[model samples]
Target: MPSFHHGAVEIAYLDEGEGEPIILIHGFASSKNVNWVYPGWMAELTKNGRRAIALDLRGHGDSGKLYDPAEYGIGTMAGDITALMDHLNIRRADMMGYSLGARITGWLAYRQPERLRSAIFGGLGIGLIKGGGPGENVATALDAPSLDDVTDPVGRTFRAFADQTRSDRKPLAACLRGSRELMTEQQAAAIRVPALIAVGSKDEIAGSADQLGKVIPGSQVLHIPNRDHMRAVGDKVYKTGVLEFLLRRP
Candidate 1:
């Protein structure tokens, strides 16, 4: 429940465990608990003797919410992560993110590679290079009054997830509008840190993990069987692969 100022917004975060730090970034409509804690990610990482930290992005969880779309740009979210890093006096740490968080990780890997010992991206892949985004359907879904009023399948699912999570709708909608930019192939190719992309074999939201690894050169890929985006975050296979990667690399 501890919080700090990052620019004009107050970012809330949880810092737990001990040893080498690893920041955990949750996906869209997910708080740190829903994304990492409830999934036993913190326990697993900490049990392995690594410090675990997670924060609510500006529009998500307990972070200060901004209704304006401009406040949730991809670059802005990346800055929030670095600002948290600065606040903690930690220069570099291994970091991991899922879905929207993975996209933010992509930005960080490009924008502040110096601040990362390694990067783990879950539920995202080469789609960043293909130029697609959540678009107006997702925004409209977030704006809809109820699930019955939503028609688009993807949007309906996200809207329902938001409702289930009790997320602030206005800010989440604005986030969908502002942070939809995916990474370009050139940017993905430019990542200089050790990285891993773990994804569900059935996850349609993230693009091809194989294509992403091929482009990143030396980046490892873990494709969890019989899982989708919603299920992939909590999957044991994904966690095992990531832990092994971090342990081996560290």
Candidate 2:
């Protein structure tokens, strides 16, 4: 339940164990507990003698929520994390993120590669392209009714997301609308640290395992069979794969 002020926002985080720190960044809409703790990742990391810290990103969980769309941009979000690290006096640490969190980690790696020991990205790929135009308003995108209005397969996925949003509407909607920008190839190639890219075998957004593996250089890709986006992180294969990758490094 401890919290830190990162500029105007308050980021809620959990710090456990007492060794080289590993920051776990949760996905859009989901809190730290849902992404890492509920999956037993914190216990697993602590049991292995590594310090694990999971943060509730701004506008999610116990963190402050800003209704302004500009406040939710990836750059702004990444800055929040760097500020959190500064507040803690941490020079560097291993970092892991999923979905929107993964995008933020990518921005951090690009901006301050020296501060990271290693990185793990889940449920993301190297398609760093801009979605909406620069002047387009994020609120407009979010205000549009559920994607069920469209006929494409991707639209169906968005509709499913919208269904999830109804249960916990604010945070997930903010995340979905906020993550309009994509990661550039230049940024992906710049990540020289030991990287791990993992995705569920059935993750529609990231595509097949081999396709994702080819984009990230020096990345070890693990496929969580019979699992899709929602179930991947909790799957035994995903957990074991991530731990093995993290422990393999110095």
Candidate 3:
């Protein structure tokens, strides 16, 4: 339940265990508890003598919410992570990010590679353009409700999304908006630290494992067979691949 003021927004996060620090960044629409803690990742990391820190990105979970589109940019979110590390006096740490969080972690790795010991990215990929980057697309999406008040195809899709948003729509929407500026293949190639790329075998959003493996240099991509985005992170295959990759000395 501990919180830190990262710039103008307050970020809520869980800080537990003690050893080499590992920061866990959850996907869009999910909190630390729902995404990482519920899966027992905290205990798993702690059992291995590694500190686990799961952060509820700004505008998600118990963190402060900002409706301003500019405030939700990817740069701002990445800055929040840097600020958190600074506040904790952590000079360097391993990082793991999923979905929107993954995109942000990529940016952090590109911008501040020196501060990272290693990184794990899941549920997202480079060159995947969906919602428009930054303000325009996000502002538009945030204005639209999950339900469109019609029974058409679009409405049905909205209804399904609404069900997922029931837990926390505002932050989820903000994360979607923020990720519009994710890096491209050229940018991702600039990363020098050890990296891990993983996705569920059935994750259409992240594309095929072969594609992810091709882009990152010396990076290992693990495909959790028969699993999709949500299931991949919790699966034994996914956790084992991630833990092993993180603990390996480069």
Q: Please report the candidate that would top TM-score against the real structure.
A: 1
Q: Report the lDDT tens digits of candidate 3 across residue range 136-165.
A: 333344445645543454334423543564
lDDT of 3: 0.74
Q: Global lDDT for candidate 1?
A: 0.89
Clashes in predicted model 2: 2
Best by lDDT: 1
Q: Cα RMSD (Å) per model?
A: 1.0, 3.8, 3.2
**lDDT of all predictions:** 0.89, 0.72, 0.74
lDDT by residue for model 1 (56-155), tens: 9998999999999888999989999999999999999999989889888889998889999999989888876774446689889999888899999999
Candidate with more favorable, higher lDDT: 1 or 2: 1
Tell me how candidate 2 scores on lDDT: 0.72
Instruction: Estimate the TM-score for candidate 3.
Output: 0.87
Cα misplacement distance, residue 33 of candidate 1 (Å): 0.9
Worst lDDT run of 10 residues, candidate 1, spans 126-135
